[model samples]
Target: MTLTLTDETPPKGFERLVRAEDPASGLRALICIHSTALGPAAGGCRMWNYARWDDARHDVQRLAEGMTYKNAMADLGLGGGKSVILGDAKRDKTPELFRAFGRAINALNGSYYTAEDVGTSPADIAQAATETPYAVGLEGGQYGSGDPSPFTAEGVFQCLRVGAKHVFGSEDLTGRQVLVQGLGHVGMSLAEKLHAAGAALIVTDIDQAALDRAARGLGATVIAPDQVFATQMDIFAPCALGAVLNDTTGPQLTAKLICGAANNQLAHPGIAGALHARGIRYLPDYVVNAGGIISVAGEIHKAGPGYRRDRLAGIAGRVDAMLTRAEQEDRNTTEIAADMVKEILASANRNVA
Candidate 1:
């Protein structure tokens, strides 16, 4: 199906370019949202063969907005934005396609920067970098670029430790059973941490290679993705896609804690309350997964390695503080975390103007 782009999306406080032809690569393009509230907008460029244009639009808008909040929460001086290419990643990838993407990004005049996301890789970002110097997360030990997935995993692992302390009143995962849904880079890293802490690990992924790796490397029990939602584990870690929590699956979860690297995990606004009703503690996705953004933000602003490390370590500590506040105030962790993020963003806005 040919997906057409509409020019009428809330004005977005920026520009939206939808192109079909390119001198570099011939592919459908949608450069969504450009915001200058903080500084230059930086976000991942996700490539996927969407079932519809609307799906692509939703992904770009939601992800761009998530990036905005993610950066704001991390105290990064970057606005949020995202780009999406409609085509099969495996079948339609080509130099021409990426080159065209580079050109599109180049036209943005540095208003938006691109990075790697699901279906997009560092190699792809490198290809796009060939067209524009604004692209980030390039491989080859580039000076200002590094893959953010591992950092994302590190943050999630730290948040899990915090969750354990708040709910179980201990940070040790020795006897805890964690069901990690999605054995990708982030998920596998988180599982390794859990294993290192002597926790029992159960992992699931659609890719057999990932499953086999988890089983071999971490001694994780591989299960089907669907089983993760209903697994009788202490923690349900979702390191996969977004919107996994909803009416259907929220009430069915048997895990005592829900924490992972996935962004925008809640299907809707009320899902947090649903988890609360079931006595399930949910670590807010945006707050917990801000590690990658923090790392990248440091690099972009030339904050140095020590600053980045301090920032990453500070995530675990902040998670601990948030959890403690939640328990002390008899409030849900998600609510308290969101309030913290809101205050941070508000402070940032004040600083900016």
Candidate 2:
């Protein structure tokens, strides 16, 4: 089947959405650039076996916009962009496929820079680098940041500390209960951090191997994936796919706080209000999961070696400030964060003009 771009209305606020196909490698890709107010757009390249072309487009659009907020709030001086390749990560990835994708990125002339996310890895990015220098997160490159997962996990962990402080009057995680959904690289890394901090963990994953490893290595209690939302815990850290906190799961959450590395966590904008109505404090996903982009941006901008460490260290304070502002202004965190991004973007645009 020929994958074609949908004829639906273009995503609001997006500057460009480029769809490409490589017949030779059977590759179909969508690159969405949400903004360039700060600078060139930068985000991850996700590879997944999307069931439909429209699904891939929607995912790319949401993710790209989230990156805009994430970058602006993180003060990265970068715009937002994302690329999605519709294919299975393990079975369909090929050197030719990434090269074709890289060529597509290069065609943008630095309007978008690609890195690793979801189903893509550093090795896959290295393959894309063969065709275009627009890729980051490759191993052994002069300025590459090998894997951003650890950094991202650290950011989430720090945000969890902030949430703990706000909701429980303490940042200490000792003896706290945390249910971490998804044991992928970022999730597993976060589990290790939380465990080391003396937090009891209840973990779940679609991959049995990953789940087993978390149980054995991290001493996490393994639970069925379907049981995550209903589980009682102090914190619910969703490191999995987007839209996990929809109508079905929102009302079922028993956790006091929600903070994680997943992008577009809310099924829709109103879900934020729904979560707030239930007295669950939500640390905005984009603000908490910004470590990956911060790491890659450091390398791209030739920031010092300690840039990632320093930036990650500041996340807790940033989250706290945003939370405090939300409380003082009587608004949900989503609105507070969106306003912050808007101010930054407006200021940048004014300076550019």
Candidate 3:
């Protein structure tokens, strides 16, 4: 169930912890990097039934590193780390398993903190807290502290506006035909913003309830989840899993811009060149989808007592600026935005050094 490929590079400050209790219930965590340059590393734990252990390991490593860059780019004073549970969410989810994972993290003291992500929820985080006090996003009866999907979607929405301005001449979403490839929590939240902007929405989701919700509430036109490969729209928003822009789908895309909350949109590194060839403006995932982490980081650091909404609204403005700078520099938005973030981190590193 648990598979790992050891490498020397190990992603700067990588730490892998595995707790084997039985063949069926093993917990594995990979903390890809430490941002002692900033502060304690904090991130969400993603639980999924990856087909292979290598797949889960790869996902954890890449996502953890992405979180580091995302936090640095968003000016969050926190490092990045991620946890992955290798099992089916529906059938394999047990409080015991989560508790085991929490104990594993507890052993690390506070080097890597955990929250809710993907298949994990607030209740699961609460279960995790039963073992480790480091877990966040607890339910205190009022509004839950977990489920940061809407915040993530809001950030992506802002980034999309910036992309629209760069690709077209306007930042408004009105009259834009936006095709959303995933109807998950983030995608659905983003759909509300697109609808509010008077954009024509084309939605796709494997979950019928989510599709129905989008159709009934947002008046969005639902499409088969796989049909996004051939959908014709100004923007192709991928809010779900990563690596959708592979060789097979990249060449056939009709969207002028590809900007969304999904991480690692390119199936491979060369896909960027291919998207560049197609004139598709690619917004780097970490830069665009950082609102959730920013919010959680604020909570974690006690940055402020209030102003959460205003802080979130500011992400849109920053995204818009990044988009404008990319067009003015005549470079791919992904490269430009990522380079800016790298410069910031490099500066931070130098000051520390």
The numbered model that scores best in TM-score is: 2
Residue-wise lDDT of candidate 2 within 1-353, one digit each (tens)? Answer: 23334323557778999887888877789999999999999999999999998999989998898788888888788899999999999899889888788888878888889999889888888888887878987777567787788989999999899899999999999889999999888999999999999999999999999988888988899999888876789899999998999998899999989999987789999998988877789998889998988899988887876888877877777788888998888788898888888888999989989
Worst 10 residues of 2 by lDDT: 1-10
Q: Indicate which candidate wins on lDDT.
A: 2
Q: Quote the positional error of residue 165 for candidate 1 in Å.
A: 1.4
RMSD of 1: 3.7
RMSD after Cα superposition, model 3: 4.0
Cα-based lDDT for every prediction? 0.78, 0.87, 0.75
Looking at model 1, residue 249 earns an lDDT score of: 88
Q: What C-alpha lDDT does candidate 2 achieve relative to the native structure?
A: 0.87
Which 10 consecutive positions of candidate 3 have the poorest summed lDDT?
1-10
Error of 1 at 87 (Å): 2.4
- Stretches > 4 Å off in candidate 2: 1-12, 22-27, 48-56, 86-92, 206-212
**Candidate 2, residue 201: lDDT:** 91
Q: After superposition on all CA atoms, what RMSD does each candidate show versus the true structure?
A: 3.7, 3.4, 4.0
For model 1, residues 108-154, the per-residue Cα lDDT tens digits are 78888877776777788788889798777765543564867778888
* Comparing 1 and 2 on lDDT, the stronger one: 2
Q: By TM-score, how accurate is candidate 3?
A: 0.84
